[model samples]
Target: MASTSAPARHVPGFSAPAVGFEEPFAMLEACHERVQRTLALLDRLREHVRQQGADESARQAARDVLRYFDVAAPLHHEDEELHVFPLLLAQAAPEMRTLVQRLQQDHVDMVADWAAARVPLQALAQGEIEGFSESAEALFDRFAARYASHIHHEERQAYPAALHLLEPALLGRMGQEMAHRRGAPER
Candidate 1:
């Protein structure tokens, strides 16, 4: 029998029927919102796996996870690496280069975590994510753990560095660049 009880699901970070922008911070803030929503969905997916209901949900959450892994995550990384990091690296004290490397390492590590998840997640969406051998629960757990820590580290360490290092002029250029990247017309 199909369960009648609606599972208590976490709310997604975005809810309105529209998307809006308020200028420079909009792209960054939207990325933040995307990560939050995707994390919430990831948490729910983990919960479903814990209940051994991956088969039940058919990994419906995979769609959202895949979208995040492919789009939002990569764009944020690109913005940091190509735009923010280079600006910081150009003028940061020599002593701080190591911090930059460590932050970049965090991005690399998170990419690896996503790499590890892709095949199994793809398979899962194919109606048999693991062929009865792979532990779907284990897979989801590892992905969640790696990604959650990555986000926390950036929020705590990397973002502050960018904020500190970017000059007002560079920041304006960055705002324009990011806006262009997101398809906003010249302002």
Candidate 2:
């Protein structure tokens, strides 16, 4: 008899969670989890409109997506910019500099893409529109792809490099600042 296993699923945001803000890297990972979850929700929204039209579920999904990207995503980016990037820029090897620059540019592009998606998404959330434009859908795809790639790069290279570059004191400070930024109690 041949052994069989369950088919692998590609759920984007269901990875292991970050312990808390006390561990800054863990918190960043947690933020990425939420980003994945929210992006998945956006995909569901598209499907919902296709299958069910602009119903209550779609509205709620839109609302959830807006809340996350508007509030959490910016903070996540800020956390990286404030605590992670500077250290890397100053300390990482020469080869990493270009990668860091590209990541920074990604941040800029993400912000712009979010703004473009937001207009249509906000309307959808408010029940002002029953469907999204083709441009909005394309923007969402681009946004998701950019995030997926950005997260991949950070996890694969930048973050691990940061773990080595930053000292204990700096890591502590990063955790504290991250906690305070989120209004989470310092751990």
Candidate 3:
């Protein structure tokens, strides 16, 4: 008798729909949603590796996480550094200024953390490893934790404060610059 079980289904990672650059703040917030989803995927990948030992699904998940952090994440940071941070630094109150400085440092730290985390992930994505080392897992944990805190701070405080400070004209200009840098079509 032939088997009747269905083949396994591969569910792709969740990604929020793209928001246009015309709404730059919304675009940034959308990026935050992507960040959270990618991080969740990373967590799932880690667990999958532990149980499944770098199967094709695990490898693909590693690739997805790497691609987002490598490409989209840096651009998101640049969007804030170039457009958002300057406005806050120039006009927001001293407390907000301190928060922005800390956020900037968070960006620096995240870059360093990603550099370390990328190594084992690269090996996994290339089918060179079955699972992460203790140190590598720790690196991943720290990286995710930092991003959680950083995103929370930005969403709760920095974004609202910056949005309040920006006039419509400046916001439009900021959006244009962001779109130009990413080669995104203007709407």
Among these predictions, the greatest lDDT belongs to 3
Tens-place lDDT digits, model 2, residues 27-111: 7887787788789989989989978999988998888788778866887899899988888899999888789999999999999
Better of 1 and 3 by TM-score: 3
Q: Which stretches of candidate 1 lie over 4 Å from their true place?
A: 1-26, 50-52, 55-57, 130-139
Arrange candidates, best lDDT first.
3, 2, 1
Checking candidate 1 for backbone clashes, the offending pairs are 123-129, 124-129
Clashes of 1: 2
| Backbone Cα, N, C clashes tallied per candidate | 2, 0, 0
User: Measured by TM-score, how close is model 2 to the native structure?
Assistant: 0.89
Tens digits of lDDT, candidate 3, 8-120: 32212213345667788998888888788889989999999998799999998898888788877887899999988999999999999999999999999999999999999
**Ten-residue region with minimum lDDT total, candidate 3:** 1-10
Predicted structure with the largest TM-score when compared to the true one = 3
**Candidate 1 residue 134 C-alpha distance from true site, Å:** 6.2
Q: Tens digits of per-residue lDDT for model 1 on 119-149?
A: 6666656666533234655665666676567
Identify the superior model by lDDT, candidate 2 or candidate 3: 3
User: What's the lDDT for residue 121 in model 1?
Assistant: 63
Show model 3 residue runs off by greater than 4 Å: 1-18
